[model samples]
Target chain A: MTEEIIIAGFGGQGVLSLGKILAYSGIMQDQEVSWMPSYGPEMRGGTANVTVILSDDRINSPVLNEFDTAIILNQQSMDKFESMVKPGGLLIYDPNGISHHPERKDIKIATIEGAKEASELNNKKTFNMVIMGAFLKIHPIVLMENVHKGLEKSLPQRHHHMIPLNEKAIKVGMKKVKVIHDYKKLVAEE
Target chain B: MEEVKLMKGNEAMAEAAIRAGVDAYFGYPITPQSEVIEYLMHEEPFKRTGMVVLQAESELAAINMVYGAAACGKKAMTSSSSPGISLKLEGISYMAGAELPCLIANVMRGGPGLGTIQPGQSDYFQAVKGGGHGDYNLIVLAPSTVQEMADFVDLGFDLAFKYRNPVMILSDGAIGQMMEKVILPEQKERLSNEEIIKHYGNWATTGKPESRESNIITSLDLKPELQEIHNQHLQNKFKTAEKNEVRYEQIQCEDADYILVAYGTSARISQKVVQLGREKGLKIGLLRPITLWPFPKKIISELADHAKGFLSVEMSAGQMVEDVLLAVEGKVPVAHFGRMGGMIASPSEVLDAVEKEINKI
Candidate 1:
């Protein structure tokens, strides 16, 4: 199986770091992975995004036009990537600062109040971890233990002290996610 | 011990140079490739391996410094993007003329000038067809994966020394910025000055003793007759390399009706196209040229006899396609598909292009 994901947000929202963690987790699980970031001036306070691929087989293209999942954090990203999701795929977003919500009926859609959860925890840096937690709750592609190992490997030794706090933030996200649309449920209703 | 890590292609190149026993690194910072020097500076290779890593005042100065260090039989390298590479062409030409051995990595961006900071493969002719001047060729290696970005550092240096010519790692920003798992080779000890004399004293400007005549390293000969001979010597050396160092990979080509030829970033993208086409029963294959200078012409010529058509995919405006056409010699229909100005073509688009050519056939 292969999971192609795009995580997009402002540069300081930990978008790239979240993708790096997921890539590291894939490595820990002995799966092939690739991480390609949209770099350049856009990285300086502008909208930044990274394309991440995790697969049971060798990955062919790191730069893809479509994705199985899109984890969007801001309205700009939502506007850009909501239409890029493959049919029967998933899209998860943070519902803060988003003026127009996703309106797709063909895929799964969910929202996690990442900013609110981070503010409640009194740590804005854990925003990405919360979002990651929400993603894992929806689709547990990787084991929790591997995610912990990935966090350890991604962060430097000095940052190890904050792993517990990040873990707490992720747990909060998993509990707080709201599923707005499910294609399978819609099909059953029809 | 072998170590595995997820690293960007540029960072892997720097770490590989350090692990390959490189004696010095002289380079100026440039976008899409500055990570090579930044990683080197952060790692402090001087402290770990006694290697010198210097940020030269300019691209010109950096390449000249490489010339100075490499003349003494030391392993030296430099890296830059398109514009910065243009600035180093004079030094590169001189190095080729003098028959010096050193590694130059060009992480290319879009350009005829300062076009864009995005990745592009437009420098194909500049690298493989003698970028600077005269009839000199650089052994150009195109790496499609992060692992090759590391492995080719050692291989480039080896080819440079073996042929007494300059070697180039021709990559683009896409591969340079992307991250993937790489199994890094073990650290190798730098050669001592005494060892240098023992290994390359025949030509290198190591200290001269009473044992033999002084070694002179120069591309200058005022006499026209001897200069022609020197040109012939360089040509013969290039011919030998073309015979012995051609490297390429063919995937699913045994019974393919169409073939896609590409290198570096374009090759990775076309590999996806190959899979996409095969799923639809199109019988497509891909040939990736690992060495751009000693291009896999012989194999391509052979493939042209059987394959109904060929599609050359690139990030340029049909540069390598010229060589593809020359190799195929009109044996089959040849088409070119690409996206310029840093825009990459998608797998579906490339598949459509090859399918169009096959339909015509």
Candidate 2:
């Protein structure tokens, strides 16, 4: 199973970090992983992005022409990557940022106020964790336990207490996203 | 087993480097090729395989690190785009002059200045003809597919060591950024550090110079005759490489009336043009050069006998096409098709150029 996901947002949104976590989790779950970042000259205050592909099988290419799933953290990100999503794929958008919901009917669109919900936990960065949890609940490609361990390793020691908070954020997101059944249609679901 | 998986050429090159048993990676982050470093950074090949990986201060530092590691005969590589490569030319010329083997991958982007981050193949002259000011040629391997991205590492390093010169895996942004399927080779056989040191450690400035005379590695030759001799020797090695390492993919060329010369990312697009030209009953064929330095000039020269006209297609304006004319040597008129400044020459555009050329005569 190999899944390609793109996480994008404005600067300082931790979009790159979220992509790194998925890459880390893929490695932890005994899969070949490749995480690619898009930072061409624009260092800060610019759009940031990361492409993460996880496969139980060998990974062939790290460049993705079309992503199987796209998780957008802001309106600009959604607008940027919405065109590159594979048909009938999963797109998780933060409702707080995206004013216009995507018009695609073939793909499953879950526009959630996940960021607003995550900010309730006193950290807006946990919005990615919230999206990650929704990703796990709906897709469940990697084991929740493995992802938890990956988060533990990736998260700073100071935020060790936020582990529970992240977990809860995932649960909140899991409930809101549309549960996808066709495993073949998604990624890494052989 | 042959398999297909969608991948970008840059990522595939990184994966291929790992498979090629690259011992160390010292490079600065750059566009169109950053995916290679990003892959190694997160995958942390060093943690898994104990390979040395460092993001250096500058491209200058990165190439020097390669020079140092290659002196020890260890498998080391550095990747960069256009402008960054200009800085490394001095080091590359030095690596050749000093007789060190290393791998350098350049996913070429637009040139001159900070042109654009998008992909362009304007570095052909810089790569094949030698961008550095010296009389030396790096074995340049240009891959047309993602598989070649992985496959060229083994080939690039092999040629580099065989000739004792730095070799380049020349690819562009289209190949770097585009996704394609590739089958990875098993990397069980790798050169150990001790083995590397044992092979080339004698010259490596390793706590020595007191026991024996100092071993100075430099390209400077005060005597004109000595410099000419050195140039001749370098030319001889290049001739051997040219004889031994010429690689080209020929398709629909069995009875080809017209030949198309292309390489790397441009080759993939040229393939479709060959088919489209064939469909139009043009008796057209394509020759995709896999090795840019050890060019398949001999083959292209031979193809000139039966061919009416040769069309050289490239992403750059007309760098590689000059080589085609050199190879053909007016035996057949060599035309060109290209889209520079980050423009990709599509299949239809190539076919249109061929058709227009055919109508000229």
Give the winner by TM-score. Answer: 1
DockQ score of each predicted structure, in the order shown: 0.80, 0.08
lDDT of 1 at B235: 95
Q: Per-residue lDDT of A122-147 in model 1, one digit per residue for the tens?
A: 99999999999999999888888988
RMSD after CA superposition, every candidate: 1.0, 7.7
Candidate 2 has a TM-score of 0.68
Pairs in steric clash, model 1: none
TM-scores for all candidates? 0.99, 0.68
Which lDDT tens digits does candidate 1 get at residues B53-110? Answer: 9999999999999999889889999999999999999999999999999999999998
Give the best candidate by DockQ: 1
- Once fitted onto the true fold, the runs of candidate 2 whose alpha carbons sit more than 4 angstroms away are A1-190, B1-6, B188-194, B197-215, B223-225
The DockQ for candidate 2, computed on C-alphas, is 0.08
Q: Compare the candidates by lDDT and give the number of the best one.
A: 1
Provide the lowest-lDDT 10-residue window in model 1 chain B.
Answer: B196-205
lDDT, candidate 2, at A190: 36
Instruction: List where candidate 1 sits over 4 angstroms from the true fold.
Output: none
